[model samples]
Structures are given as C-alpha cells and as structure tokens.
Target: MKFSLIFLLLALTSCSKKEAESERTAHSEPAWDASFFSPKTGEILSYRETIESISPQKNLPISPDQIRKRVLKRRQVYDGSELIEGKTLHRYSIYHDGSFTEGFLFHWVNGFLYVVGSFTEDQKITFANPPIPIAHLNMIAGTYWHWPPQAPAGSGSRHIGLEQITVPAGTFDAYKVSIRKNTQGKITLREYWFAPKIGIVKEQNRIYSSGHLRVINTIELSDRSTSDTSDTSEEAPSEST
Candidate 1:
C-alpha cells in the first residue's frame, strides 16, 4: 500500500509538469508571421479616401458636391511594450494626416492577433475587458473569427482568399478579408485587401441603417514610403481629414 501511494503522487506530479509545458508551448508558438499586417517602426502608408453619403429616406445618393475626397497618410512608430490588464502588449503610435492620432495596442497569443486597446493623447489606454481578435495568424481561405467574442451571431470576419488588386501604388496579389458587424439595427461591412510585405492596399466600408445603405467609403493605397528614423512624405493630392 505504501509503494502504491508513492507511485500515485509521482504520476500526479508528472501530469502537472506536462500541463505547464503544454501551456508554455502554446504561448510561444505564433499562428503566423505577425508582420503580415503589423507595419514596421518607421513605415508610412498613404491612401486616397473617397466618401459618399446616401439619404436613407429617399434611397438616393447624395449630390456630387457633397462627396468628399482626400489623401490620408498613416505613419507607424514603435511605442515599446506595456503590461496592460495582466497581458503584455506591444504599442504603436499612429499618425494620421501628419499628426498623432492614437496609439494602437496589439497582443499576440496562441497564434492570434488581438487589439487590446487604443490610447489617445498622453498614452491613456481604454482597455477592452476582453481583447478583440482582429485576425488569425494562420489564416486561410474561408477562415472565420468573431470579435467582442460575445457579439451577436452574424458578426465576424472571414478570409475570402487571395486575389490580384490594383491601386495607385501598383498591382499586386493580396489577401482579401471581409468583416461584418450588426449593432442596433445598423450593419457595417468592411472589406480589406492586404499584400504580403505591403500592408493594406485597399479598403471598402459600407454602413447600412434599417436595411438601407447610408454611407460608403473607399480607400486605396496611393503610395508607400519607409524610413529608418526620420519622417518621410510622399506627394499626393492635398491632405484632408
């Protein structure tokens, strides 16, 4: 009886060690290359944006004069790592149209990319109780995932396979993904095309209220530039927004 008890304790210890190792392995192994969507420290991406508003009651598009067009430049700068809500997340400063807009915090765990939170001015972060999963590291055609994990049924993102897309920057093969969300009788659909090394080449966003399209926005990459430490600018149409 004494020997049997010793054996049982040993077995339990062994199982506990195995479980701990498994957890570590899961955290160490990333699903895919994180750089697929995450830009480098000193990379700048310029995009041309066009926005069109539609009248829900009349179901007619707005006048041409009401449509807005502008050039948006986004610069990404490394902001070091921080511990937030018990998770270590990497932060990046986002500059929009040549001014600091916000800090984007990202966490990678179990091969998934999650947006932990965003910080506006002074690095003040507003945490999302549960980090939102933006993409699966190991994405493939038909891959699907939902954000706000507890969101309503029909709210999620899907990979629509790879396709050749053309923008002002030039044509390249890119992965196409579609994201849909439903909230308070309003539905938002966003489609994004990302190139391997280059980030988002194009994005289309449509918002529908009461089953009628209310707004449409399209953004296409106009140019992209990279620098080591200094800011670089690409000449495009005058900036707006």
Candidate 2:
C-alpha cells in the first residue's frame, strides 16, 4: 500500500484516540512555515501508527477480534533520487513491523509534487497526477482542489488552513489538509498535518460504511534521522481514478 501521509495513503480503518491525546490534536491555533521533501540518502523518519476498529464489522469478515487498537512502528528512508522521464524523482524505502516493504517515488511537474510513479508486483508503474497533491506551495487559506481528478464521484480535498500542532516529534506550524470521498455507499476520510521541511507530522484516515465508521489508522511522528546509509528498499502501483 502507498502509505504517503508520512507520503502514502491506501485504505484503512478507525479507532478512538487516548483522552489526553485527543485533546491535543484538537488545537485550532492559527499557524504560519521551510522546505525538503527531497532528502539525502539514509534519512529516516519514524511514526507510531495505531489501527483501531470503530464499528462492529471486523477488517476481515471471518476475524474474531473485532474491538481493539493495535499500534505499529513505521519508518521511511530516503534511498536516493533518479531521473525518470527527464525529471528527478525521489525514492523512499519503507520499513514497518520490523520488515521492509513497498516504497514511493515523488517528482515535480510544473512545480507541484506528484507521486507520479511507484513499485509493485516487481514492476514499475508511472502515471500522471497521483491520488494526492504534496502541496501547492503557493496556496493560501481557503483553497480547494481535487486529487487524481478522475477520483470517484464526491472525492476531493481542501487546504483547510494553517494550524499549529504539537506531537512527539515536536511542535510545528503546519498546513492542515483534509480529503474525503463517498462512492458506492462507502466513504473515505483523511486529514493530514504537514510540516514544511519535515513532511507529514500527523495524519488520520477513516473508512465508513452506510454512514457508520468502520476503521481508522492514525500515525504520529516520533523521531527522525538524516544520514548517508544505503540500506533503504521501495512502493506502489499505478491507480486510475
């Protein structure tokens, strides 16, 4: 899965946040911003991910455990950059649950960050606009835009505004972005707090069925490191909206 909020998003479930934690994320303090989504090799960013079930339905129909929250640690490393189609795309390696899996590649087209490409099924797939827009740096408050314009009916996003948020990684004056779409009676909601130079500091994704929440995945940054190691791996398949 292309877990991009820390540059990836696929599908997920929902869970409730700890009492104290819930209060902090509710901060509505207005905020203001740096830059590098592109990093040197060996740069590592780690997050604490919590997966929880919000409805009676299990992630899998036959599963027995239906109520609970499970936390996992996920890390991403900047492997390097490559020239694809005459443009530079950064490659990132993902590590989660003590093992390596799919990674992501990002490139800029006319100044906007587009995922553009990904690795999947042992093959590489390249495309146009991705499911999400990294940032429209020039965007100001009250901005609205849609991703993968071909998104299902009702799918879209908005740059809500600037907000100050505090998490394990520290406090950041970040941009608040929200995305949502309802299709075939299923709805997906995603919100992200992104820091300029550091990328996504916090994010939450929720899926709903028949107007009821089904699952949620929340990720918060815990730590980060920048180095020159070459051990990182790569993600993703082309998605057509």
Candidate 3:
C-alpha cells in the first residue's frame, strides 16, 4: 500500500512539471500574425515597416518626403455634415518643422481625440469633455500616427492592411493599420483612403471605443501652411535678351 501511494505522488509531480513547461513555452513563443491579439495570453504584437516602404498593390509610387507632406497637409480642422451624421469640427495642427498635433471636437457634444504627434513625435489623448469631428479622425487613420514599435531614438514605422472599400468619388486603395505597443504602453488601429494622385485624401480611426476617437478630427488644407515665401523673394532676377 505504501509503494502504491509513492507511485501516485510521483505521477502527480510529473503532471505538475509538464503543466509548468507548457506555460513557459506559451509565454516565450511569438504570435502567429502579430497583428491580432492573443486571446489566451492577452498580449498584442504587430509587424514593422517604414511609412515610405509601405507600397500599394497597384498604385503610383510615393516617396517618404511626399508621404510626410501629404500627412501634414491632411492635418487640419474639417467641418463636414455628411460623414459625422451631424455637424462636426476637426482641428489638425502641424509645427513649422513638421511636428504635428491633431485635435477633434464635436459641435453638439463634448468629446475629443487629440493626436499629439507621429513617428517623430507621436502622442494621442482622448476625452469625453468635447466632441471632435469624424473627418479629422479619418486623416490620422492608419499610418498617419505611429505608436509602439518605436526605434532607438523614439522613432518607428506602422504596419497596415487594406480591406474592401468604396467611396463616392471612385474605387481606390483603402488601408488599415495595427500599431505594436512601444515601451509607453499604447496601441492604436486606423483606416485610410488613398487617391492615386492626391495621396491619403481621407482617413478614420475608432479609438478607445468610448464613443470618441482621439485622432479623428477634421481639417481643410487651406488651414495648413504649405509653402515658404522667403525662398521666392531671395531668387535672383533673370535678365531676358
């Protein structure tokens, strides 16, 4: 009888060891796609790539500088009645040197999504105090704001995906983005519409699910500064024969 009891204890010990090994393996291995979260583990992972390296399947080639310019231009306050299901206002703010801040405030309500920056200086703030519009929310969608996966000097790229999309203007490329969390403990998902020549003309973000998107503010290009008059004034006059 004593020998049988010892055998049972040994069997229990073996099972416990196996269970511990399985748990360790689960935590060590990487995820499958890295875009979706692991429901079992509750951990999120995402792929990495630079904004300029992200290429469309069958669209015109766009350079990193061009993409950066387009991102700046799209950052501004927008007033739209159609997209928001009501009147809404979006504010996009960009500094002289290309630093960006985007804020969205709704007219009838109090809720806002503030995108404080990008890969260069990317931050997001969402609050229910004021409502930021949807058009502005779309601009910062996808690759516009880079969080998580940051590099050595607080810079990183976003990995995006494109699904089915249709718009009033025409059929174009639509993209979705998944941000891998940086050391800052932040993550975001976004969607975008890129027109062939105009670049990323529209975007949308579903941030925080509190009925408010921190980055979905609207803007008009007229609200942003796109040129420098100093260079033009310094140009030498050409004497014609």
lDDT of 2 at 132: 50
Q: Indicate the worst ten consecutive residues by lDDT in candidate 1.
A: 232-241
After TM-score superposition, the amount by which residue 16's alpha carbon in candidate 1 deviates from its true location, in angstroms, is 33
- For each candidate in the order shown, give its overall lDDT on alpha carbons: 0.70, 0.66, 0.31
- Model 3 has an lDDT value of 0.31
Candidate RMSDs in Å, in order, are: 10.8, 17.5, 22.6
Candidate 2 residue lDDT tens string, 139-173 = 56777776567776457778887788777776677
Compared with the true structure, what per-residue lDDT tens digits does model 1 show for residues 30-111? 2245455455555656677777775666444556665445546655565555455445576777777778988888776776
Best by TM-score: 2
The Cα error of candidate 3 at residue 203, in Å, is 1.8
Per-residue lDDT for 11 in model 2?
A: 24
* Maximum-lDDT candidate: 1
Model 3 misplaced stretches (Cα beyond 4 Å): 1-164, 180-186, 209-241
